[model samples]
Target: MGMLCGMAALSLVLGHADARGDAPPPAKKPRLVRAPAAAQPAPAASPEAGLLRGPATVPAHWSRNHCPDSIPEGAAYYIVVKGDTLWDIARRFLGNPYLWPQIWDKNRCITDAHWIYPGDALIIPEVNVVAPGPGGAGAGTEETPAGGGPTGARGPSTPGQILFPSIEETALQCASYVVDGREDESLRLVGSEQGATKVAFGDRDILYLNKGSNAGVKAGDVYTLHHETYAVKHPDSGKAIGLKIEVTGWVRVILVQENTATVMVEQACADIHLGDYLKPFERVQVPLVVEHSRPTRLTPPSGKVVGTVVDMQDDASIAGDRQIVTLNLGTANGIAPGSLFVLYKVMYPSVPTPRIVLGEAVAVAVRDRTTTVRILNSNDAIMNGDKAELQ
Candidate 1:
């Protein structure tokens, strides 16, 4: 009964609405809702896009976003980005965006800071980033600094010139390090060769090395190839052990393979054959500090600790064409900054003398003057000119 009444009331309301519709009712439109605005995109940095207007043969740049506020007037920093823009990042690193171009110009690698994606590393430059003007990268026909060349600017001369102590020309400025591992090699014929043609060993074959290019094998790479030979006593009481061939000699790795490699056959006098095993003929990597192993007691006959000059950062020491090339020495060698000692040359002494009897090595960086030599938290190397001796 309730349902019937409800239906009847609905019909009445519908009928009433239809009767009133004759008064010309218009069409109804649905309301639309507006969406919230999004954040604005960062402004583009207008780094100079022209010729090579930078100092030296090489130049670098801040290849990351910058925070405008953090950047100081003349500080060195690599641009990084997490939630920042070039201007913001610049300000954060350099303290100003007007100095962005100076940083941009010095960092020639950063051609397009916009395209600088995350994870791409950059080499930040030191102070005195010359801009594009008379002292900067401005194109002009005027006098330039001595080391400035045409586009670069040279700083005024100073008195704290630090030059690297002269070393033997033999010890090269090699790209990497070299080691010593030798065991007085010797090769000799085994038995009589009266009629040894096509002997019992003819059944065994040998694998010869055919070295190829690109291995960078510039001589002195030893290859040890071996073959087993078993034999019994002919007409004796005791058994004698036969000697398998253990040949070794320096070779140039010519043909490099995916897994297997080929090397030149340097010594073939021992009647070499086909099936001989080959690999790097390694002796022994003597400890950084080894005891008596050399023919002479003075020498170590093994590996030695080595280091190189990774940086030279003394502005005052860079005058007079003399770069204060710091060495890989210091407290590790029992040196401290300002700790004075006579420089000596590292020489291998003769019979009566011991190896590395120091003679004359130029005094290099002091603790402070040395590159990457710190005397802070843990241990700092002594200043340049400190004595370098072998304990």
Candidate 2:
């Protein structure tokens, strides 16, 4: 009985010690079982992430809140890349695939729409689009005006409102003639619009000429009207340089006859008389651009002042703004309509400089031996003896 009690007491003591939590940890998994590799963090976004987006996709750079109704003028451009097509480019930039020809027309370098190399920059012209808005129309959604634009911003048209001169106005404003000693020339003004009764004529008047089909005159052909007024004498030499031909008007052949042609006076700067001469008209070159590229002074090859302002349309001794003046230089001296020139006065008799800048002139009509210049602007009065140098 004593031995049994001792064994029970020892077992109870061991159970109490286990309940006190003095146990060892379990063993880890064996070496045969492998673990997974750690996951990598994603790469940072690229700096050009917005630029590389496909053309068909709306650019990420566009503001979501404020889309435009039309592409503003001179706003956008595209750099050509390999495998780019005009169709895709138009759709991407102009928002319409059918407008691909617009792109082709603008980019002259694209000789063939099918073949385009990288690195060519293309201009994206302004285009109208129906931008979605709260009212289904937006800020630039107005209809074009009747006379000018879709926005109705052109207002109304009025007579005499046009400040800039028209082609006919600019052409007919001056006169150009080459006097070659044809006093009894084959072509001459036979009579005025009022039969042979009228002595003088004006613009838009009918006139009779002495030559027609037999002289190879066509119905649409234009002619210049002039008469040798006086002989232009050289200032120093006292010898005759060229004849001073007074340009009276111009005419367009209308009716044809065996030896006569009826013509309408297109313009008459002076009174047109019966004895005025007629010569074939010359077309005007040189575009009337908003700005002309001209040298500050005369350039070489045409450096020297080769001509002088011999006459004025108004018959005034001095010419001011927008006055017409005649120059000795013509097509023979490489002068053309739209040719720029600087008018300067000689302070001293022999010295060309310091050039007294009289003004600037533009050649509106160039003839064989003389040119018609319109004084564009002048700081002072432009005289007849003023010098002209090509720009």
Candidate 3:
């Protein structure tokens, strides 16, 4: 009886399996299909990529509508809007449109002076205003004597209410001058890493310097890159006084080896090239002073010292206002930087002719026997060999 019961149970289980044999195959498991990742957009090229001094990052407090209430010490903020220009902004805030470069110097994010976006933020530098009192506004004030005084004598001063801007930093940095002696050639721009496709280098270009740690060069050392253009001859004596050097650019040492150093072009006023000489960097600042009024009537020579305009930087036959010219008079003639000169023309030394006044210039850089002057104003074209009298 037990065997028969077991046989019956096994047959029932087999019958149930046979009934489900034809039943639908097991359901398929769904496969996951991921969507393609969204494509990332490329970064826009900066218009001022190689011109900027440092890496640019958008300011955290930047806004198009309003500037932040809190600002950096000694600095104010300005939010750019459409149709805004650096020139206009400078005139509106600094009271001088020519001071736009100062505004540009303060804001590193601005790449091009021509294009400032509406959302961009700018830093307005504080202008030093003189207060009314001695040693402040009218301390050094002097009147233009009916008869001109000696060269060392002060020229006429502008009113205390007027303010003049200093020389543009770029002009002062790239200024070419006549040197009494050859610049030290110990350091030179030997080569560059740009291979051979490029002959001219500009701002931020990597370059190799011939000088290194052995020559007192170290990381962070700054130098002025320049090249001698030609020898300057005295207009009257007809003798070689010095060589004229054209500043190509500036560089900073990044790595120093035994006999070589790696440098980067910091500020480029012109194209830099191999074989350019280097000198210890100098910081030049042309101070602000009361501008002298242009002399309208003929003024007698100061008789302190007389010189001639030897050459001009541009080599143009004629120079007008705000041009750079080389002068034969220098420190030896009691000519110092910021000294004023009255430009004139005397056709004949023997014959008495009217001292034709041309323009005025100020000594910017002075050596023992050579000086560089920037023509402040000119009613007529100033040329080489024009007479410059100390004022």
The TM-score measured for candidate 1 stands at 0.19
lDDT of 1 by residue, 265-345 (tens): 443324444444445543211000001111222424121112223222232222112123343433333222222111222
Q: Give the Cα lDDT of each candidate.
A: 0.27, 0.52, 0.62
At residue 13, candidate 1 shows an lDDT of 21
lDDT of 3 by residue, 1-391 (tens): 1111111111112113323232222112211112112211211223232111112343654332233334444334565555566655655565544435556656645533444555565666654322111221111101122223334422222233343432444676688888878878878988999978889999889999876888889897778999988888866667887888899878888899999999988888788989999998765544333444676546766544677888997567888787888887766555655677789887786898788899888776777877788887888888888888776
Could you give the candidate ranking by TM-score, starting with the highest?
3, 2, 1
Worst 10 residues of 1 by lDDT: 284-293
Among these predictions, the greatest lDDT belongs to 3
Q: Which stretches of candidate 3 lie over 4 Å from their true place?
A: 1-149, 153-161
Off by over 4 Å in 2: 1-174, 178-184, 192-196, 217-222, 252-254, 289-307, 330-336, 350-353, 367-369
- C-alpha-based local distance difference test score of model 3: 0.62
User: What TM-score fits each model?
Assistant: 0.19, 0.48, 0.60
Q: Count backbone clashes in candidate 2.
A: 5
Measured by TM-score, how close is model 3 to the native structure? 0.60
